[model samples]
Target: MATTALGEYLSARRAQVTPELIGLPTHGVRRVPGLRREEVAMAAGVSVDYYIRLEQGRERNPSAQVLDALSQVLRLDDDAHLHLFRLAGLLPVPVRPAAPEQVDPQLLRLLEMWPDNPAIVLGRAFDILAGNAPAYALFDGFQQGPNLMAKIFLDPDARSFYPDWDEVARYTVAGFRLQQGRSPDDPRIRQVIEELSQASPDFVALWDKHEARGTRMTSKRFHHPEVGELTLQINAFDVRSAPGQELVVYHAEPDTPSATALARLRATATVESPQADQDPGQPASSRSSWSGSPR
Candidate 1:
């Protein structure tokens, strides 16, 4: 029997919801990892057989109300709830080819203006489309390639570069899952996922969790070889001019040790000009590329 995306997603999510999480008493040794089909059906006001059919790909279409109830029982967040709807075909999934990512000239200028803040523009597949000097300096040695996912997971020094390696890995995988949901058919996204899955066991483990969420404004600790330990808050903004592009800026609070370290790093970092033959429109200090494509 062929398994549908909806079925696979439902099964994965169901396995994550514990019986105790929904006030169901755990009396004996349970064979399954999470709530049983019958328990889920009962909680969601559906028949056991119907729920089973949903998980087995026999049931194709379910009402919005039913999906909502199942989402509640599964304890899904906003992103996960939306992802479930998309998998169930209740929400439209935009199908488009991955186009070459180009950072807008105005955005590039904006990045050049912020000498103190480390800012980078990320493509749909988390490719480093563009980065100012400070941003490049911050990422420095760990940026083995253009893709942030590859740098975080495939790079040998990534674990040491990020003190919170485990947390960073989980967050990166979850963010990638969110991007995958948005562009399910994009070859670029698929290539990145396939490559990481083959290369990193840790990535495979985190990807299996099926957590779909975008990157939020959060503080991240980085152990820069030159600057020592630094904690910076990351802020990500969607590029309204171009879809599937995000501008991520890292900043340290004023009057903090991190701020002092960042200032020192910025002061020591020299901006690199674009090559003579490089695009004139491209920012002088910005490093831009779509080099994440599979070799």
Candidate 2:
């Protein structure tokens, strides 16, 4: 209906480019920074007039082919390429969405049965879709206002949560960036990204690098306030039937202190009940402590 918003994207990207990047000759008198529309058109195998029209918002609809050409010539990263499509009003290529990812009833039953193992099911955006009692007790703090990303990045004692805090932060940001690339328009995701960017310089630095990686499997350390540090092998798996949902299971080495700590954590729940169902019997802070237990 209306002309696209390509002008701003084009302008911002243009200013960031240097003459050397596009193989252009520069004289001492050349004042404007970055590649001109004509130079970009030449590099992209398009005419100057067409490029000008696109930049001026006169060309509202560009084919995927054309967008691809511009993307390559400008050396736009994945995020920048997607942003260009959004600004150009070209229907972005469809991507997977982390919609209602329901856990299998059988899995729920299994979790209920195992009051001893700490476990949780997470969605693509780090939403805690479901978790078990042992998991609830071990990670009690992260559960109440549970946002996995925020917990890792915003919490004051996050370093204490993970002994390898730097590595953990990098992985967390990279995972968040991957989801952001998939659904840039989600306000909640955007808000989390912005909030984290403002809150953590390390997070901001990692984001600026434009890294994107999914957390499939890793080892993590948890410094439990009660039981000291526990190292566990972390396993992450996707529910093929329910796209975008992942089951992250934590296992302590057999007969280790971590395992003993987990036993103590699990002992909190002699009988597994739905968190809401168990709340009546437990104090609010005690319930919170159960949910905030470390993985």
Q: Which run of 10 residues does model 1 get worst, by summed lDDT? A: 286-295
1-295 per-residue lDDT for model 1 (tens digits): 6778788778888889999899998887899988888999999999999999998999999999999999999999998899888888888787765556667778877887888888888878887777777886777764457888898888888888789988888887788887888778988889898999999898888888888878563988888888899999989999998777788899999999999999988886556623223574864221344222210
Give the per-residue lDDT digits (tens) of candidate 2, residues 1-295.
2334466556556766777887888778756767777888888888898888887778778787888888887788775676566656675533554344456665556556655567777655675667777777667666325567777877787788778888887887776765665566665577667877788787776776555566443778888776677887888777776655677788888998888888776677535444545433332221122334433
Worst 10 residues of 2 by lDDT: 281-290
Q: Each prediction's Cα lDDT score?
A: 0.80, 0.67
What's the true lDDT of residue 68 in model 2?
Answer: 88
Off by over 4 Å in 1: 215-217, 273-277, 282-295
Give me the candidate number with maximum lDDT.
1
Model 1: which residue pairs collide? none
TM-score, candidate number 1:
0.92
